[model samples]
Target: MERNPWSLGWIVLMCLFVTNRARELKVEQVGPDNEAVYNHTLATTLVEYASAVYISDMTELFSWTCSRCDGLTEGFEIIELIFDVEHCLQAYVGVATNLNAIVIAFRGTQEHSIQNWIQDLYWKQLDINYPGMPDAMVHHGFYSAYHNTTIRPCVLNGIKRAQEIYGDLNIMVTGHSMGGAMASFCGLDLTVNHEAKSVQVVTFGQPRIGNTVFASYYSQLVPNTIRVTNDHDIVPHLPPYYTLFPQKTYHHFPREVWLHNVGLGSLIYPIEKICDGSGEDPSCSRSVTGNSIADHLIYYGVKLGGETWGSCKIVMDQRLAKFGSKDLGGNFVFSKNPASLLQAGSETGSISI
Candidate 1:
């Protein structure tokens, strides 16, 4: 074995060549083209809506300010974005004549607030701290239970205090990510309980909760709720499975009223029926299911410019057990343009997983 040093050198060179080729192959497997992460383009498209809502809320808040009005006040409320410790939630608040009470509660979950918090704190660039770094950190339900529980009550209490003092004044609820979810829940509660028909909610990237029964209950309970989910925004499609099925009911709005398809219906069926079979390998199957769901939520929203009311409406008709439908795209929201990505998905693969 020690006879030829030249032979040993040849063997080492051959090993190095093989290792280099293997490395290249692995890179290809995880590269952008093969294992790429699809982002939502809806944010940009829906910025106008976001800005409009923000401005409208601001206008109303400003109108509420009365320097001499006994309980009225005006100032920037510092929101400590808990998800990203660096930034704080800053809002232009016009407190109506309620010096001794809390009015107009602003609530949200983690994804909404955290992202805003990070942006506020300018810490989003530091997404390198984790293993998957930014992408590996799954942001399905941005804020965990701790954040949700803590924030929701504070917001409710603030609203209660304000309502008590202001008597007939209005309550405006809003949030970006998880904050949006918190706002939605609070709005749902207020509307359901008959606290106020004036409860206005404007949320971005909001998640789904409860079951169809809950959805229906809220629809009846809170009609003024306006949730704007950007095309393919994944965070909005949460509360994945309906636990109490047979007894529980489901509710879907008119096609022209929904914000996005949400991918919940389409992706769930395929993932559960096909990819998640016994014959498939565990890892591959899981990836297909997870990615498909993620793709449905995020990419679909992104593609549709934060508008899915029409698509969702169509999906609802097909998905509902008893509801009979006449046409698929009859209530379609946007103009059927060939250049639109949403249309492209429908023709080829659909925005579902």
Candidate 2:
């Protein structure tokens, strides 16, 4: 069978288009300090724990009482759970006894519905700068959600408490989608302000959080940042990264692990591509059509968000029955003095940023 000349020409033109795009993108390789390697086991494990944070009962999470958290929290000790009423943000800090590390997981906007988050991304609301980084301009809403929310103080309190109790262990910060954006902010906060020793940030399906300047400054601040995006995951494409207008467009920080299917026909094979240090590598997920919202829900066969995992409201089983209201969540002891985390203050973990 002879192929049509028109079809062959079209294929050649498409190839040229792809090749030109790749050449235009800045695909820089990170230095040894960046620690941008992908760890399959770790990524899978962390996402599960991140999903477990969706447990609505703050008390259950603090006590490590939720059955949903059982698989993820086997050796993890829940320290604090913050459900910010005003902004509707949920996050929790816990100590992984096995790893001897402090894990901070932020629950994404899935509570409100993923569509709302995606629709909000269509706006071009850029903020001025990220604290000390004067040139780093970020998304206004993401910056405020992290810096201005009640979740900030509560998270800090939790980290401080963990430090006081267990000493300065490693900090692993992670989340999915909107949670991922917050995770990046939290990692930066721990790095500059808190004087945290070791901080690692891994986010899944995270949107472009800031402008080009902000992405650079964030890389310098928190070098150990990994962004995982699935093929056709639309969130990463939002606020739109324009090659010609990068300074004005929203950009992501390196490095990104793109999960894509390379299978032919019905074979259905998937691969994890650890992209170049440039967060906007054109050859990676940026090469595909990012229009599938369905691709945003799963990473490494781990289904995240939606009605399937939303039934933890009752929180039945052994731990809940064991505590039974007598033991309230006193895990994180907040200090009145903003500087102090070791010395106990009021039970209320609220502070202005």
Candidate 3:
């Protein structure tokens, strides 16, 4: 076969361009302990759930948790959207139609009770607030694969799918933990591509992705995305969540993560130097309490179902399954009670930011 040199060169350049543009890890840093400003800063990470919590808000965003509604087919409504860009994995998706907007939900890790497996992996090898924590976590085999890589494609595919359905409608991307990260990436892409007039992101217990530069770029590129995190959710404090594409990073862990493990220590432990300092910085010290991961894990139970840890996991799993199921809008049928999920917050689901 004869090959043209010019064409080959062009192909190679295109390949390089696409590869570079694709979601890959980059690192950067921002300012010091500035929680007020830091709450809004953007960051990314591979191991931690940092990416999950980063999100933006919108004017039309609304929520109406309902056991039943008239327009909705089901008594409860939890819509998710999944896409397979290259037909990689048969992605699952569901969309809930609210008053005037749409809630873009993303799926996450499956349910498991393998603390021992996690412990055997050597808790010390992983980053934890205390030395024995990694060990303890491993003993419980409570590990998660909700990393940056797992979610990037899911989000990319969703953006394309959402634009296709409600191209002109406003979007509010939301998720908890890993799902939150996917939502963040998806919302950012929507803004960049001009798919919607506005994009609002609301997440809980999300970790970081990319790095400081990525966060800055993300914030500059899409200012409307607002990330909401609990005072301290452990899952949101993983190490990879702390460093990415290089930018200033923030850690949201409760004091217990620190108090419980003297040897383990937290990734943000260093911030105490400034956050805990006297005068105006005391607030920074207080902000560093709690564990984002724990908060994330427990949030499902508090917001979705159950009152116990195991029940929380079950509720979260069911909710994620709700999002991951391909049959919701396709094969599945809904009842009126579930219709409330569609009508909950915000009527138009449109934000022009």
Candidate 4:
């Protein structure tokens, strides 16, 4: 039988199409069943508390001890403050006795120094040993600042003290912006290196920490990490995923809990998406428009009403009012209205990612 050239071509095309479709249908299943599972009520409460802690750390006028501190949820009391002069990192370890959880909240960029921003710019390599796991390399600056400074020791000591007093409570590590990055590092370190059990990390508006390998390693070690990104947040897109320089390649973790706005006013809900756990998901924040800072500031604000709203903004507004607009070493500038702080900054502040 003579095969018709056109018929043969059609057959070949059909085969190719079928193969491609099968590949597409082969979904890349990543992580466990409960990997990216998020509890709306729990996440809202935790993030709100974390944001409040950040605001408290940023503004000295509103002490952490203040009962009416904005976003200061009841039950969680600050036990210790961790500070690193060289790294310019500050965090507080708080205890929620009723919940049996210890919250380690990191302070985001503040008015004192641009060290956090400077750390973001350092994308070099610094390898570390991970026992019973793959050898991992992280952001050089982040690792150095985290390792060299007393931050880690202070945190570990705080956790130890808490464990001694409370007896094996859950450790919840959290932060916003630069603090988020540090939170990620601490979460991974504590889980993999220190063998700290039941460590849950929830970061807000955090930037990418390391390369693909580091992300995968961190994801496997700390599966419960939930990165919360607001709509069009500029910080999450930082340190460029696809840079001309080879060493500059960075990736995010697998789980992302995105807070999407329903309408104009404070109505928002979280939608959880699980990537391949490889950190290179184009569908995540890496592909979004990198122009909005409003999203970062309003993480736990009233407009997005829930347990988390209005507290962070209240503290921020108070701080800004107390200290007028100056180069607070952070990116965004403060205005009369805390919400306006997000809208006031030049988009150039965000490095091209």
Most accurate candidate by TM-score: 2
Order of quality (TM-score): 2, 4, 3, 1
Where does model 3 exceed 4 Å of error? 1-99, 111-167, 240-286, 290-293, 304-353
lDDT of 4 by residue, 103-131 (tens): 88776766333334534454534445333
Q: After superposition, how far is residue 200 of candidate 3 from its true place, in Å?
A: 1.2
TM-score of each: 0.35, 0.77, 0.42, 0.65
Q: Per-residue lDDT of 1-353 in model 2, one digit per residue for the tens?
A: 99887676667656644643443211122345655556666676688777777666544455555555666457577676666655667787878876568899997774455776688788766766777787778887877888887778879988888888888888989988888899999999988998886888888889888988888888878887789898999988887888898787888889888888663334444566778777889989899988988888877766666453322232223323222222133222212222222323344343221
lDDT for each of the candidates?
0.32, 0.72, 0.34, 0.58
Clashes of each: 30, 0, 103, 5
lDDT of 1 by residue, 1-353 (tens): 35776666556656644543343221101223222111122122222222221221221222322221122123322111111111122122223232221233332322243334323422111121112122222122332331333434434444544444445555555454444545556665666554665554545545443334444455455544445443333444342323355223211211011132213222311111111111112332122222122332232222211132112111111121121112232211111111212111223321220
Better of 3 and 4 by TM-score: 4
Comparing 1 and 4 on lDDT, the stronger one: 4
- Clashing pairs for model 2 are none
Candidate 3 or 2, higher lDDT: 2
Instruction: Kindly list the per-residue Cα lDDT of model 3 for residues 1-353, writing each as its tens digit.
Output: 89877676666556644643442221211224321122211221111122211111111111122221122312212233232212111112234343234445543332322232123322323222212112111111112222223334444454455546556445556555545556566665666655555655555555554333445455554554434444454444443333342223332221111111111122121111112212112243134653334444443223421122221111111222222333322221112222334323334333221
Candidates ranked by lDDT: 2, 4, 3, 1
Model 4 error, position 142 (Å): 1.9
What ranges in model 2 sit over 4 Å off?
1-33, 306-353
